[model samples]
Target chain A: MFGRIFHLLVKEFLQMKRDKSARFRLLVPPVIQMLLFGYAATFEVFNVSTAILDLDRSQESRALTDAFVHSSRFRIAVPAASERDVRDAVERSDVQVGIVIPAGFAELLKKGRTSPVQALVDGTNSNTALIALGYVGQIAGSFGQDYARNLAERTGRALGRPMVSVGLEERYWYNPNLNSRWFFVPGVIGTLALITIVNLTAFAIVREREVGTLEQILVTPLRPVEFIIGKTLPFFLIGLLEVSIVAGFGMAWFHVPFRGNPLVLLLGTCLFLLAALAIGLLISTVCTTQQQAFSSNFFVLNPMFILSGFSFPIPSMPQALQWLTYADPLRYYLVIIRATFLKGVGLDALWPQMLALAAIALGLLTVAVLRFRKSLD
Target chain B: MAGAIVEATGLSKRFGAVMAVDGLSFAVQPGEIFGLVGPDGAGKTTTMRMLAGVMRSDDGSITVDGIDVRAHPEQAKRHVSYMPQRFGLYEDLTVEENIRFYADLFEVPRRLWEERAAAMLTASNMTPFRKRLAGQLSGGMKQKLGLTCSLVHTPRVLLLDEPTTGVDPLSRREFWQILYSLRGEGVAMVISTAYLDEAERCDRLALLHDGRMVHCDTPAGLKAKMPGAMIEVAAAEPRRVRDAVQKLPGVAGVLLIGIGAHIHVDDAGRRLPEIAAALSAAGIATTEIGEVAPSIEDLFVALLENERNAA
Candidate 1:
């Protein structure tokens, strides 16, 4: 059985080496997707276009405008002469954020009177809008704090220290600075492996059936179990290699840290790949053509990806979708990988996820084996 | 049957409402080339697949080299090599690579495959193209490669389903020569084909119609089973000759050939002169008229026509 599977591995590798499209597909897309997701598919909202309208034209208002311009989060895309201009920039989506300062804003501040500034944000993409609003809040609050400190110094009552409002001291652990690339690059590695490995294994078997090679192989002394092992083992190896390349690229290019035990990562990856390849095998068993296999892959992969918590948190999903995610191998894999990459946790902390992944892999592999028959019928 | 290397008894396979192979029974001895001669949809492929242990029969059983196929197909598969009509060759792999893959699949030892592959490729005239990709090979070379792969393990029983259906005449002849050479090594071969002329090359064949075995015998034996002598008559207007001769006594049927017709008569000695006279009487100038030995095609047509008329 080992010999047969080894020969099959050799054959599969040779085919992969000779077929230009397969070679390209196996090597190029992961790198491209790593770059795309690492840079583009990010949660960090940067360079948000802001339109500013300072009605007071005072030092206080100009200072606030300068703060918005100097901060990396907001780029002053338009200088508004009137509220109409700020509203137009916000409405046309030319600027994602708009700030309008009222008249006497600096006078009210000098007199220690209450002052208010109106901020407008486009909520079409509520996530980006919310993140941008948070940045705006931070800049405005710091500016107010500075003014309060100056007022205390002038009055000589609080000894040049600003009066404290409710204060927030925030520290982001694991990923300091909340670098979204560091968070996303690891997830990209998992998602890319899932998509590409599933497709490779599914299409490989379906191509055999389509080209009439599967029937030829069945008549040999090689058993169905042997054939299934032989067919899938190569892809399992490829999945590991692919994950390594993508993970290495993520680490080197995106600086996503891999702080966990190498063995733990290897175990998680093997379990995940087994589950993914088993899904591919199951799809191959049900489909008669490459088109059917491809569509079926899309049907399964989309839900798996959505429920995997690659981008969206599992708890944030609907109740039924959350339950559905329990069955997604990618969900467990994502947890294991993220915990491994970010928290540097080993099996003690990740055992439940590892167990869930192992169960899923075993269950899917069992079903796939049951479905695959050594007969054309 | 006792000495047969491959035996199938009362095999029946149904696809939906169609009985693709109904009550099909046959046995092939060692060193024999058994042909499943049929038209399209005649269950030749189904029967071949069943015998090769790659398909299950709805009824009956098959044995390869005394191993029960359905009960233990994998064990039976150890001794049988099946090459389907469309033998899947990995287009990206070279011819040598394909042979090695199958050799490995069958668990042929490295030394054994090296020797067997060298001989097989040389015999098939494919040695020069060993390193060429299978996708680059012509239709005939692809078929030859498929055959070589199928035979790499030197299987006890070889099943080929329409191996030469689309191959050129020369390649088809060459393929049969390879099969004949295999016969000397005591390999039981079951080959199916829609080409009737090729059926004559088999040692014996089972003639199938609508998934049932209508007749099973050697090619000459099948021709001998024809109820009457075949009288071949050539004329400019063969249809006119057929019209006149088919109406005469002892005439069973008329089958048109190129510019002639094979007239089936109960007694060719009596009907030959009468057919000639009738064509002359009808003003259809005859090129030739004589009793001719029936071919497997003639026998098949006569048998099918007889069954249709009987039905």
Candidate 2:
């Protein structure tokens, strides 16, 4: 059985090597996708155009406007002549956010009265809006605090306890810069490997069936288990190789940090790939045609990617979907990848996710083997 | 040589409402080419699959080299190599690679691999093209290579389903030569073919129709079982002669053979004058009328038509 599986592996690899197009497919697309998506699939919101309407035209309002212009997150638009001008700029998408300061805005701060500053924000593309709003809120709050301190000192009165005592200092651990690329590049490593390995493995058995080669092998003495292993081992190795190369490129080209142990990454990658390849084998077992397999891939991959918390945070998803995501191996893999890439987390911190991945891989492989045996029978 | 290497008794198979092979019984001896001859959907392929232990039979039993096919398909499969209608060879792999793949699957020892492979390749005239990709080969060469791959492990029994269906005449002949050589070496072979001419080459043949065996015998015996004599009638207008004579009494079946028509009739000595008279009255002048020995094609057609009429 070992000799037979070894022979099948050799044949599969030789065939892949001889086909020039297949060889190119093995190495090229994943690299291109890794680089392209690393740059493209980022979440950092920058250069957002903002329009300011300051009715007061005073030092305090101007200082707040200056802060918006100086920050990397927003580009300053022409100062609006009126509230109507702010509306026009926002309506035309000339500005994503409009800051409308009231007529007594500077006078109110001098009197230590609460000023209601109306900041109109576009809610489309919610993630960008959310981040931009946070930045806007911080600038406004700090401006108020600075004004309050200046007023207290200039009054020559004993500074009593202030009304607003709530102050927050939010610290982002690991990714202190909040670089979205750092989060995306590592996730892309798992994603690229999953797509390539699943796609290739899905076609392995189905292609043989379509070309009439699988039936020829069935009459031989080789068992189904041996065939499954022989067919999957090379692809399993290729999946891991893809992970190392893409992860390396991510680190070198994109400067995405790899702070975790290399061995943990390897272990997590293998477990994730084993589950992915097993899902592909499951698709192959049920599909009789290559077209059916290709269509089924979309069904499997789209849900897996969307629910994986790769780009979208799992915590924010609906409760039902969050529960559903727990069943997806990619969800656990993303946890391992993102944590290991940014947090420098070791196995002790990541054991639960890793264990979930191992369990999923085992279940998927067992189901695939059972389905394949049924297909043969 | 060896006693019956493959014995299938009272075999039956069904697909939904259709009975593909029903109540079929046959045995193949060592060193013999047993042909399962049938038309499309006649259950030749299905029966071959059951005998090879890849397909389950709805009823009855199949044994290959003394191993019950249903009970131990792997063990039964080890003793046989079944080349399905489309002989599956990896198009990208070289001919040599395709042959060695099967050898490895069968776990043929490295020491015996060269000797076993060389014999098949040389017999099939594929030795010179060993390096050629299977996709690049001509249809005939691919078929020959498919056979070589199937024989890599030196199986005792071979079940080939239409292995030579679409090959060129020369390749078909060469393929048969390889099978004949294997037969000489005490290999029992069960081959299925739609071509009646190829059926004549088998040591014994079982004619199947609608999942039931209508007749089973040696090629000559099948021909001899034709219930009546066959008369090859020719005239100026062949279609007119065929139309006129087909209506005559005692005529069982009429089929076109080349430009002439071969008519099956009961007691040709008695029906010969009546056929001549009928064609004469239709303004078709008969040039020849005589009893000819039935070929395998003629016997198959006549038997199938008889079954249709009885049904």
Candidate 3:
């Protein structure tokens, strides 16, 4: 059995090596995609175009507008003379945000009363809008705190008692700077590995069936289990190699840290590869043609990708969908990989995810093996 | 029957509403080449697939080399090498690589395959092309490579389904030479072919029609059993000759061949002069008219026609 599987692996690799498209697919696309996703699949908002309408022509209003200009997050691309201009800027998407300083005229600050600043936002792309709003809130919040502190210091000198003020201190864990690259680079490893392994595994078998080699092999003395092992083992190794390439590129190019033990990541990868290869094998058994396999890959991988929490947070998904994510190997793999890359956690901390991944992998492999019959039904 | 290497009894396979192979019974002896001759969709492939143990028979049983195919198909597969109509050779791999892969699949030892591969390649005149990728080889060479791959392990029973259907005549003859050599070594072979000329080369032939075996015999026996004599009429337009004589009395059928027509009649001597006279009167010119030995196709058509008339 070992000898047969070894020969099968050799044959598979030879075929892969000789076929130009397969060679290209095995190496080039993952790196290109890693670079693309590293930059494109990001949540960190920066240089958000802003329109400023200062109705209050006072020192305090100008200071607030200056604060927006100074901050790296917002760029004062449009300076509005009136509310209509701000509205037009936001409505036409000329600016992602519009800041209107109402006609309070520094009186509220002098009297120690609260002032309301209206932030007009374009909510078409809700995620960008929400993040931009957060930046706006932070800038306005710091300005308010500075003003309150000045007022407290002046009032305390007159009253002979210090005023108490509340302040919030925010610190992000794992990702010290909350760099989105650190978060997304690890997810890119999982996503790219999944797509590459699944496609290679599925196409490997579908190509055989289409070419009629599968029927020829079945008549040989080679057992079904042996053939299955032979056919899938090379792909399993390819999956591992692909993960390493993508992971290594992520670390070197994006500087995505790998904090966990290497052994733990290897184990997690093996389990993940098992699940992915099984899914591909299952698709191959169901499909009689490569075109069917291609379409089926989309049908299967798209849902798994969405539910894997790679880009979208699983908890934020619909309740049923969140439950559905429990069955996706990518979901558990993403957790384990992200934890390893960013948190530097090992088996003890990620045991639950590791176990879930192992269970899903074994379950899928069992089903795939059972579904893959030596006989043509 | 005692030493029959492959025995299939009352085998039946159904596909939805179609009985692809119904009540098929045959035995193949060692060193014999058995042919399944039929038109398209005649269950020859279905029968071969069943005997190879790659497909399950809905009824009956097949025993290949003392192993019950249904009971232990994997075990039965050990002794059988099935080559489908489209012999699946990995096109990207070279000729020697393809053979080595199959040898490994059949668990043939390295030393044994090294020798076997060399011999098989030489036999097919593919020794020089061993390094050439299978896809780059001609269609005929691809079929030879497929055969070489299938024979790497020296299987006891070889099941080939229309192996030479699309091959050139020269290649087809070379392929038969390979089969005859294998037969010399006592390999029981079951080969299916649509070409009747190829069928004539087999030791025995089973004529399949509508998923049933209507006749089984040697080529000479089958032609000798033909009820009517066949007369060949060499004409400029065989189609017109066929149309002119098709409805004549005592005429069973008229098959149009290249540059001539084979007229199946009750008695060739009696009908020959009459056919010639009728054609001359119909303003059709005939170059020659005489009795000719009936081919497997003639016997097959006559048999089917008899059954149709009886039904």
Candidate 4:
């Protein structure tokens, strides 16, 4: 059984090595995708173009506008001539945000009266608009607080005598720096590995079925256990290699920290890969055509990405949806990978996720083997 | 003659409402190329798969080299190599790599594997392209590679399911040559083919129709069992000739051959004058009329027609 499996692994490796296109597909695309999605595909909005309608034309309004320009979050495109320009700029996406200081903005501050500043935001891309709004609000609030303190000191009154005294001390646990890139890069590693490995293995068996080579393999003296092991092991290793490459890029280029033990990470990745390859094999057993395999893979991949807690937190999802996450090995793998690579957690902290991944891998492999045997029958 | 290399008794397989192979029974002797000749959907592949131990018979038993495949498939597999209609050859792997992979799977000793791989490659004429990936090879070359991969382990019995279905005429001939060469070495081969001409090359042929074995005998013996004389007629209009021939007093069946027609009769030579006279009366001129030998296809068609009419 071992010999047969080993032989299959060797064949898989040789096939991967000799086929230049498949080799490129197996080795190069993941690294390219990692860099493309890691650096270019980002959720953190920055360098947002803003249009300012400084109606007051006073030093205070200018200072506030200057603050918005200096901050990396917003880039001032042009001083709007009218409210119409501000609206048009935001409407056309020429600027993402528009700040309109009222006509009495400085006069109100001098006379000790409140001024309402209208900030028009483009909500077309909701996430970008939300982040830009947060930046705009922070800048305006800090400036107003400083202005109030100065005014109080000058007037012989204390601004600290307000009825509401609210303080917010924010601390980020796993990702202390709150680097969205760091969070996303690690998730990309797991996602890329899952997609590539599952697809490769799924196509491996389906291609045999398509080309009529599966019958030859089944008739061999090799047992079902041997055949499946042989089919899956090489792909498992390839998946590991891909994860390592993506992780290396994350660490080297993105400077994402690897907080977990290398051994634990490697072990976790191997288990996850086994589960993914088994799923691919199972898909292969079910699909008779390459098109069917590809379509079925998409069916598996979409749900995997959604439930794996890559884009959204799995725990925050509804209970019924969260239950579905248990079957998704990527869900456990993402936790293991993120906790290990970002938080620097050890086996003691990540053993449950690791164990869950192992169970998924074993269960999927068992089903895949049984299904493959039935397919032969 | 040295226990049957492959034996199946009362083997049956059903797909939905259709019976693919119902009560199939046959035995293949060692050192012979046994042919299963059938048309599309005749259950040849299902029977072959069961005998190869890759499929379970609905109700029956299969023993390959003394090991009951239904009961101990793994043990049965050890003695047989099945080359399915589409032989699985890893397209990404090279010819030599494919051979080595199968050899290792079968646990052939390293030294023996190298020798066998070299010999198999040479025999298949794939030695020059040993390093070329299977995907790069032509259709015929790929088929040869599939055959070589199956032969690498050197199993006692070889089960081939329509191994030359889409192969070119030259490659199909070469494939059979390799099969005959293997037979000379005392390997039993049960090969299924849609081509009756290829079936003629087998030492014995099992004619299957609608999932049941209609006849199993030497090629000559099966042809000898054809019940009527076949008369070829070249007429001015083939269709009218066929119509006139079919309506003739002594004609049993009229088959349209290329640019002519073959009329099956109880006594073709004796009735040729009458057939010619009938063709002339029907306003169709007869160019040629003579007794001709019936092909396996004709025999199969006749047998099927008989069964259909009876049903």
Candidate 5:
């Protein structure tokens, strides 16, 4: 059995090695995809172009404008003389946000009256625009509060404060800064590895069926268990190599933190890969043609990605869908990976997720091997 | 021999209600090529799959090298190399790589693989293209590469399922040369082929139809058992001649071969005269009529017709 399995592993490895194009397919593309997805796939909007319409042209209005300019979230583009300029700048895509400080003449501050300021924002890309608009509200509100406090102090008037203002202290559990890149980069690594490895193995077996080499392999002294293990070992190693490369890029280039123990990450990655390869093997067992295998893999993979909590948080999904996430190996691995990297948590805190991943890996592999063996029979 | 190298007793398999190999039984000698010759859906592949231990038989038993294949499939597989109709060559891998892969899977020792691989490549004339990927090779080269991969382990028996189906005539001949060479090495071979001419190359041929082994004998012996003499009839319109000849008194079977018709009859000495008269009566010109040796295909058709008529 050992001999048979060793033979298969060696064969798989040689196939990967002999085809330089395949090797490049297995190695380079994942890194490239990691970088592309790392930089391009982000939710946080920065450097949002904002046009300022200074209708007041007064000292107080200029000071308000200066505060908006210094905010990191907004990049002040054009100093608009009229409201039409602000609309033109926004319509032409010169600015994603517009700030309008009405002519107050500094009298509203003197009378302790709340003045309204209109902030126009482009809503074409709604998410980014909404985030930008929120920043505008925050800056204006803080500036008004500070200005009122100063006036009260200068006049020596007693300040009346409401005790019912709720200050909710919320902390991000896994990701402190809410850095989407840290989440997406690891998810991208998992996704890319899953896709490439599963596809390669699926086609690997289907190619055998199509070309008639499968019969040749079947006639050998190799046991079904041996064959399954041998076929998946090389792909398992390839997945590991890919994870390291992507993880390296994530850490060095993207400055994504890797706070978890490397060993645990490697172990989790290996289990995930085994589960992926098993799924590929199972696909191969059912499909006779390469085209069929490819289409079926896509059919399974697309759903796995959506349900895996790679794009959306599993916890935020509906109860039923969230429960389904337990079946998804990616969800567990992604959680463990994120927790380890960003939060720097270990197995002590992540044991349940780690155990779930291990269970999925073992279950998938066992079913795959059994099915393959049954097919041979 | 005391015992056949490979034996199947009442081996049966079914897909739904259609019996693919119904109570099929056969045995191959230790060092002979046993050919299973039949039409496309004659259960040839199903039988081969069962024998190779890649598929389970619904009933009966298969013994390969003294081990029950059904009970000990892996053990049986140790002594056999099965080349399915498709011949699963890894197209992405090179000729040498494919061979090496199979050799390793079969656990051929490192030293033996180097020597056997070199010889197998040379025999298939695939040495020149050893570095080329299997996908890059032509149909003929790919078949040869597939054969080489199967033979890397040097099994006692080789089960080939239509290894030369889509290959060119020249490549087909080359493939047979390799098989014949293996025969010299005392390897028992069970080959299933659609081409009757290829069946003639085997030591013995089994005529299979609807999952049953109708007849098994040497190619010449099977042809000798053909009910009557076969005559090739040439006419301006062969189809008209075929129709007319079929209605004739002694005409047994009429088959279209190329532009002419091969007419089978009970007794060629008396039947030819009757066939010619019938053709003339039907206004179909008979340019040529003479007795010719029956091919394996003619014998197969005759057997299938006999079975159908009996049913």
Candidate 6:
């Protein structure tokens, strides 16, 4: 059985190597996506366009405007004299955020009285808008404090250094800069591997049936388990190659930190791939042609991608869907990859997910192998 | 010289409302080439599948080389090799690679395959094209490669389903030559084909029609069982003469052969003159009429007529 499986694996590898375009597709997509989404797929708001409405052309308002312009996070895209103009700019998406200073804004601050500055923001994309809102709040709160301190210095009032104060000193572990790229790159490694390995293995067995080669293989003494191994081992190695290249690219080009052990990463990746390949093999067993296999792959990958928590958080999903994610190998692998890629955690921190992924893989592969063997009979 | 390599008795199968194969029984001796002759939908494939142990028979006993296929299929499969009409060849894999895969599947050692594959490739005239992808090969070469793949382990019994259906004439000849060589190697073979000429090459064949055996005999034996002598009437207006001749007293059947009609009579020596006179009376003048040896085609046409008339 071992000898036959070895032979089958050799033939599978030879075929994979010969189909140049297929080979290119298998290895290239993960790396390209790692680079593309590494830079392009980001949630960290930078260089946000801000529209300013300066109804009061005073030093207080001008200083606030200067602060918005000076900060790297906010760039003043437009300066308007009227509130309507600021609203229009935001509505037209010309600016991601808008700030409005009222007519008596400086008088109220000098009297140490209540003053409100209106902030307008585009909320179409909630994440970017939320991040922009945070930057704006920080800038405006500091300006208010400075205004209060300046007024007290001139008037020599008792209100000095403000009465009430709450300080927030936030520290982001692993990614100190809170770079979204670091978070996304590892997820891409898992997601890309899932999509490619599933597609290739899903369509492969059906294509054999279509081309009339599988019937030949079935007649041989090679057991169904051996046949599955022969087919899976080559693609499993390909998936590993893809993960290493993408993970390495993410670290080298995108500069996502890799604080975890390579061995743990590989083990998690292999376990994940085994389940993915089994899903593909199960799909092939159910489908008769390549078209059916492809559509089935699409149906499978879409749900797996959604539930895996690759892009979406499992906890944020509905209670039912969150429960459903436990069955998805990608969900566990996403956690494993993120920990390995960014958090710099070891097996102690990740073994639960690794064990879960292994259990899922064994369950799926058991079903796939049984279905395959039954189909042959 | 050797006990039967295969013994199939009372095999039966049904697919929904259709009885695909009914009560098929045959025994093949060592080194014998047995052909199952049939047209489309003739249960040839269904029987082959049962013998290959991929499809189960509803009721039957099949033993390949003394192992019961029904009782223990996997063990039986060790000694049998089946090549379906679409003898599944991996189109993307090269010819040599495909062969290597089968060799591995059967666990033919690396050293043995290297030497055996060289000989097989040369016999199939595929030595120069071993590196070509199976999809790129001509239909005949692909079939030959499929056969070679099945033969890698030197199976005791080889079952091929319509091995030459789409092959060119020359390649068909080359393929048969290889099969003949395997027979020399003492492989019991069962082949199915619609072509009567290919049937003639088999030592014995079973004619399957409508899920039942219509005739089972050697090619000549079946022709000899033709209820009457066949009178080949060479002439124009063959169909016109067929209508007139079929109505004659001793005429059993008539099959159109090009511009002629082969009319089977209870006794052609006595019926030839009557057939000639009848054609003349009907004003459908025949050029010449004489008794001729019946072929497999004749046997099929006669057997079909016999079944329909009985029904």
TM-score (chain B only), all candidates = 0.94, 0.94, 0.98, 0.94, 0.96, 0.95
lDDT of 6 at A175: 83
State the lDDT of candidate 3 residue by residue for B146-184, as single tens digits.
998888888999999999978999989999999999999
Listed in order, each prediction's TM-score against the native is 0.88, 0.89, 0.91, 0.92, 0.87, 0.86
Model 5: lDDT to the true structure: 0.83
Query: How would you encode candidate 5's per-residue C-alpha lDDT over B18-73 as one tens digit per residue?
Result: 99999988889878999998887889999998988889999999998889999998
lDDT of 1 by residue, A95-167 (tens): 9999999999998888776679889999999999999999988999889888888888888854435575777
Q: Which regions of candidate 3 fall more than 4 Å away from where they truly are?
A: A16-24, A55-60, A78-88, A101-117, A144-164, B273-282, B309-311
Sort by DockQ, top down from the best = 4, 3, 1, 2, 5, 6
List, residue by residue over B156-253, the lDDT tens digit for candidate 4: 89988888988999899888888888999889999888887888789998888889988899988987887878888876678988877787676778
Lowest lDDT 10-residue stretch of candidate 3 chain B: B302-311
Which stretch of 10 consecutive residues in model 1 chain B shows the poorest summed lDDT? B234-243
Writing each residue's lDDT as its tens digit, candidate 3 over A1-377 gives 67777877888778777778876778898899999988898888889999999999999999998999998999988879999999999888899999999998487877777788999999999999999999899998888878877777878744222446667899999998988889888888888888888988898888888999888888886666777788888878888888899899989998888888889989999999888988999999899999999999999999999899888888888899988999999998988899988888889998999899889988988888888873266
DockQ of each: 0.68, 0.67, 0.71, 0.73, 0.64, 0.58
Q: After best superposition, candidate 3 residue B52: deviation in angstroms?
A: 1.7
Which structure is stronger by DockQ: 5 or 6?
Answer: 5
Where in model 6 is the C-alpha error above 4 Å? A16-23, A55-59, A76-120, A158-163, A261-263, A341-348, B14-19, B71-75, B90-97, B109-116, B130-133, B224-295, B305-311
The local distance difference test score of each candidate is 0.88, 0.86, 0.88, 0.84, 0.83, 0.86
Off by more than 4 A, model 1:
A16-25, A55-60, A79-84, A102-116, A144-164, B109-111, B224-295, B309-311
| Quality of model 3 by C-alpha lDDT | 0.88
Model 4 residue B197 distance off true place after TM-score fit, in angstroms: 2.3
Per-residue lDDT for B91 in model 4?
A: 72
Candidate 2 shows a clash count of 0
Steric clash count of candidate 1? 0
Docking class of 5: medium
Per-residue lDDT of A83 in model 1: 93
Compute the lDDT for candidate 2: 0.86
